[model samples]
Target: MGHEYAFDWLDQMVHELDPQRTEPERLDNYQSIAIVEKAASEKKRLILLFKQFVFREQKTRQIRNSVNHYLSAAVSLMKIANNNLNQIPTKANNFRLALESVFSCLSEVSAFIVNRYRSHVDRDISLNLVNITPDAHDLRTLGNRDAMKSNLKLSKLVTEAFSDIFSDHRGGEITMRKLDYWVSVSHAVTYPNGLLEMTTPFEQLELIMIERNFNSPLFVKYLVSKFSEGIANSEDPSSRVQALTFLQKTFNQIPVMKDIIFNNQFEDLTLTINSWFIQEINFHSERSGTVFSDLGEQTQKASKKYERKTSDKVLCNLTVDQLSIFFKAADLSNIISARSLSAIFQSVAPYLSTPHRTDISHSSLRVKSYSVEERDKSLLIDIMTRLTEQIRDL
Candidate 1:
């Protein structure tokens, strides 16, 4: 019966998309469920990509409406089951049981989707149906009332079965990434065009729960405790440094959740530590130096001078094409060490936003198939020009 309703709901949705399409006599139960689940997954990907904002908005509204329809149907059926208890006890009980099962499936499926894609979906969309399917709060209220007056066992079962969907009550249940299979299982939460990416599981989990509008008190507490331990272990500077770096990154990445993640306890502990003073001092020093010193002026002069010269023009801004030409000349002359070239690029690639696969190799660049972005190109030009100049002076 649950599958039948799911199939009908899916069919109705399809008809909305194509009015002329004919409805089949019946859809396979698993196939119907799979279709809806697949739709949810695809919608999530589209929302993340934001390719067609208007279309996605319409689809989200349609999904919310479908969820409401299911909730309303379930509630009405449950009420009927309760009303006919005395006249048709067995049938009513069976109907009620079936309704509870459907609700369980819905809640679990919602939770699973939310958990699986928590890192990818935007928080606002996650709040809707991307990550979280809104709980049947009204239905839960009705069940509570029924339990109080007459049917305690079935009502309890109904509530207990889907209790995971209730807000704020299940903090300890948030999924944690298991470390044993971290290499194979861990994924960098990435979005369209690489606009956003999070590599760490902790940050991924933090964003996931934040988007769900869930506090995850247990996770927060655990993080806070770890942070405090890091700060207090003054014995090991490395541990303290790692802790401070983590805190700084948390502030940078998820500024909105900083207060929640680093609550009053963290605030007090951080106050006791004096590393924040160094940060403030360094920031002021850097700003003052940039404004007062001739270093910036000299650097600009050198860049302009290098840009103007015909022979030196390539050194000012290097593109892949320029790099290819330079590499060919350098490789032929054996000016730069061929063996060290890949290693040097690998080290500075992230800083320059250079993209590459598993590793950089000399052969890959021989045909000029490898490409480097403009930003990285200029930096690489600077490095290579300086190295060649140093070698010449030597």
Candidate 2:
């Protein structure tokens, strides 16, 4: 089965690489013959083919393994194509196009692997890539002059291809070393400066946090450290400014992050950065009272029937004591009507059978409130589990 997949990919690549099938004239625009479109239609088609192969192989294999297969197959195909260079027509650039297409496939596959499996990548796999392409040859190989020039041109295309992917930070689970590898091998391609030199790791870290809605505790820790490093290392005012912007945006949008950042443990950080967060925390604290008021307004605008039904459904199974515990914990005693709350309890557990009262009063419910015991905690947990299960079933 593996051999069959190999044969299929090879056959398809050979057909695409055929010099006789090359149509350089097809690159001409109909509106004007004077300008030849720079679009590498053949290269795009080859990339699309490689993408299809990746997706097809994923059904039978793990995604990482499939990408490995793509790398192996792409290398083999390029070497085979290189050996057959003599077959090309004298004046045609089809051979160059074929080589560019394979390199582009390598670039695409490398970027995809880094994006999807940053944490799981087998670093040893890159060793297989040595000597697989003309670019891998040392410059001292004076006999391979044409191949060297081709390598230079293809390297630029690969680098240019990286521009779009790198423009916005790509997010995934990654270690610091692995991230450096990715920046070097994927983003930089031919020449790789580590993530620290060209850009701040904080932006990509921000992306990872954003993916989880900024709830990641570990990444929050990383964010603090990276911001410190970025501020210290960055000589450019614009870069530091950008990092500060990201920091402010993150704290402003995520309340939990604000708490984490303002915790007493982070005092080891520079006083300047610490003071910035302190000002933000103080400013937010000033407006914190409006949060509940805003929620109340939104809740009022929401369907009253839905709110009543949700409140009733959640409160129905609880004992009077449990209801009292919940109301206090949730601080819903003043927000929710005492009469409505009492009626819901009475309706579910009959007034005579349960500890519920015939008349509605906050004082009656408040009198039932007690310090939550083990059984009461267990009961609340069970109720929460059942409600979540119901929601899931829906």
Count clashes in each candidate, considering only residues at least 3 apart in sequence or on different chains. 0, 0
Q: What TM-score would candidate 2 get against the native?
A: 0.23
What is the alpha-carbon lDDT of model 1 when measured against the actual structure? 0.36
- lDDT values for all models: 0.36, 0.41
Best by lDDT: 2
| TM-scores of all predicted structures | 0.24, 0.23
Query: In candidate 2, where is summed lDDT lowest over 10 consecutive residues?
Result: 257-266
Report the lDDT tens digits of candidate 1 across residue range 165-257.
334333222221111111111121112113222534233333433322222344345445545654675455444544555554553354232
- lDDT score, candidate 2: 0.41
- Per-residue lDDT value at 331 in model 2: 35
Q: Which runs of model 1 end up more than 4 angstroms from their true locations?
A: 1-74, 82-163, 166-214, 235-249, 255-394
